[model samples]
Target: MSGIDNLPPLREVIATHDLAAKKSLGQNFLLDLNLTAKIARLAGDLSQSDVLEIGPGPGGLTRGLLAEGARRVLAIEKDPRCVPALAEIADAYPGQLQIINGDALDVNPLEHLTSPIKIAANLPYNVGTELLVRWLTPPAWPPFWESLTLMFQREVAQRIVAQPGGKAYGRLALLAQWRTDPRIVMELPPEAFSPPPKVSSAVVHLSALPAPRYPANPATLNRVVAAAFNQRRKMLRSALKSLDPAIEDHLHAAGIKPTERAEQVHLEAFCALARSLDS
Candidate 1:
């Protein structure tokens, strides 16, 4: 039995169920209970929060969330083969665990979760970035979840928390840093998973700010950031000229140099540009 609970160890569980990590699904099952519990702890105190977990293959992290005392856990697994294994976890936790066999991208989790929600997952590789972008760019401020504790390939994690003037600093850095306080909280080698991904992974903890770091319309900010980074090598004036006839004037108004490339500009300056464009 896994030390964290009465449930069978993940390897045994996977073997019994004939559950192999499928490359198409981007499944790399994290088999260590201790590591899973540590990841759950990184989400902070879950005693009062309902957690929404995506792609919970073999229920390893689900058990950790439960063993760590989450008030409720809503797990969405796309693979039907893993549902029965998760069902066993639900049986052990009684009412605390709810398993939904559906695609996380299509399913609206707000329906199953309560207020003061937190999202914790070893997210599927294929859909991780898309899901994160959707969460970060919601129409409203102070989104459905209070925080996000998620695992991503190290490169992607770096992009999420990257600073200005780095190769990793681009649209993702601006987007995540604009609305949330994101940091890399842990790193794992490829061997940490069952089949093991080619790239190393890291866990990012993002606490949603009460409001954006600076004021800019979300749609405008996204558009401006996307445009700037799409041709990052070109000077802002040249690259953004298509955006407006007087793009240089807007850049000057936002206190940005017209000749600067996208990577050289910081988040605040980008927000200022968005505001200038909105005006």
Candidate 2:
């Protein structure tokens, strides 16, 4: 038992479906069953959780989620070509696997999914960061999903978990780290993907915090972080000049320096700056 319902091998499934990964779609199929299972495990016990999988190309990760006993798997794939391929898994798993053929950006999972859903996906490179942001900043706290287990290009993954004063630290880091504890759980070589990408990839698992690390209006923090990192080399006072004329006062109130660049500011300081603006 390859831990599934004796379905055809993923390679054969690709050949039968002629699922040639399209560059326009940012497709890179993870045909490795072992790795897929590992990703499922990293998401913790999915036995009682409904799993939301984005861009499940050929249902590689989808199968693993099901095999690991996810109560149900809602596999969202924009590419119509992969829908039928996913249907086969749906049949094998009975009612556990649900395939939705549409753009992930357009679908609001909150409106449909019940509480305690865990998201696990090998997201498309083009839209992964944007989707993660959308999930992280839903006007409401504790946005639906219990956790997120995702794969991204190694460099992109680093940015998501990067620390202050690092080259990769920027808006993504602040946004992700603010409300969740994120870290890279596994790394994948370029060769691990079908139609391997130029850069290596890694898996990031983020668990939501009951509340944000610090208190700041979400909109204000977003604007502040964007301005500060928009011209990362410039000092915060200068980079944020376009947003507010009294930027120095806000920085001083936050106990941050006018000469500090974006990367030098930590999450707490950014929250302070944002709060100061509203004060």
Candidate 3:
């Protein structure tokens, strides 16, 4: 039995259900209950917040969240094979768990979640970044979730919390840093999973700020950042030339150098550039 609950251990659950990891769906199950609980703790004070988890294979992390005292958990799993295992978890936790068998991208979690929400997941590799970008770029400030504790490939984690002038600094770094306080809180080796991934993994914790760190139109910033990094190696002047005829002037007005590459510009400068372009 998993110590966290009276339910069968994840390995047994997997065996009974024949839930082998599927590569096409980006499954890499974490069978270690202790490790999953540790990851859950990183979310901080789940007692009052509802948690939305993505890709909870065999309910390892789902169990962790519930055992860690999350008020409620809404887990979205794409693979139907794992639902019965998750159903077992629901029976153990009673009213605290809800399972949805569907794609996370297509599901509107807000429908199931209540206020003061936190999102924690051992996300599937293929769709992790896309989900994160959607969460980071919601139409309004102070998004649905109060915080996000998510696992990503270590390289992607670096990009999320990356600073200016680094290889990892790009649109993701800007988008995440602009309106939230994001940090890499934990790292795990490939062997942590059942069918280990080739690369290492890290967990990122992002707390939403009451407002953006700097004021810029979201659409404009996204457009400019996308343009700047789409040709990251090019100078801002050249990379952003398609943005406006006076792109260099806008860069100068934003206190950025025309010669600076996208990686060389910080979040504040990017916001400023977006504002300048919007003017």
Candidate 4:
């Protein structure tokens, strides 16, 4: 266990600071430096990129980012107790680790960094999916961040990269795959974290595309996908009945078979339906 700066073991820091992972915050601190460094590598070369991290519980991943020579790291952590713990790292790094003791969802992180940003975090479980969706759905092409390397529960990781015909495929897969290439790079057992979570976790790295893989109205595409997946067991014609009077026409126009179910439809086909709906 190589220390980032002889900063003492994470277990000692947590114990000394009286910092216990708060259940309310969905906090599960990862203590292993080996694993955290691996996650940092998964984000690619951070030396040229500024990084934004959410919920840096105990500063393990934050240390990883800094040690890997990220240009700088801005960590937003909601837990007040972890502020000083992270501050210690900030001092050790001297101008590299910038911390915000605020809710990540409420704060606009893009305001802080001048350079291209890469986000890396072992996200708190409660808001992980919501935050990811927010990051992926900006109206303009090429979002503020260059890439996102985030950790989520294993199930959620699968959902982000899952393809059609897989049960894990749904809104997340469509949303992530539409504008970015997301893949699960590493999987961790429950024991990997302090106060181990009940389920396994995985790290997903998403590289942004200059534009969406296909053309479609974002609003229309989201609505169409939501409607179809909400009634996933039903055929497209039946599930999309609420979309418009010409649901079948839209399907046919998009070259999609009306008999297909949501789980069977691909991202390209969904984009087609969204485009057809706009027509």
Which of 1 and 3 is ahead in lDDT? Answer: 1
Cα lDDT tens digits for candidate 2, 137-193: 987998888899999999999999999978999999999999999999999999999
Give per-residue CA lDDT, model 3, range 1-279, as digits (tens).
668888888899999999999999999999999999999999999999999999999999999999999999999999999999899899988899999999999999999989989999999999999999999999888899899999999999999999987999988989899999999999999999989999999999999999999999999999999999999999999999999999999999999999989998989999999999999
In candidate 2, which residue ranges exceed 4 Å CA deviation?
1-3
How many collisions per candidate?
Answer: 0, 0, 0, 0
The model with the greatest TM-score is 1
Whose TM-score is higher: candidate 1's or candidate 4's?
Answer: 1
Q: Candidate 1 lDDT, tens digit per residue, 40-139?
A: 9999999999999999999989999999999999999999999999999999999999999999989999999998999999999999999999999888
lDDT of 4 by residue, 115-209 (tens): 78999999999999999999999878799999999999999999999989989999999999999999999999999988999999999999999
How far residue 59's Cα lies from its native spot in candidate 2, in Å, is 1.0
| Displacement of the residue 83 alpha carbon in candidate 1, Å | 0.5
Model 2 / residue 122 / CA error / Å? 0.1
TM-score of each: 0.99, 0.97, 0.98, 0.98
Which is better, 2 or 3, measured by TM-score? 3
Q: Tell me the spans in candidate 1 whose CA falls farther than 4 Å from its real position.
A: none
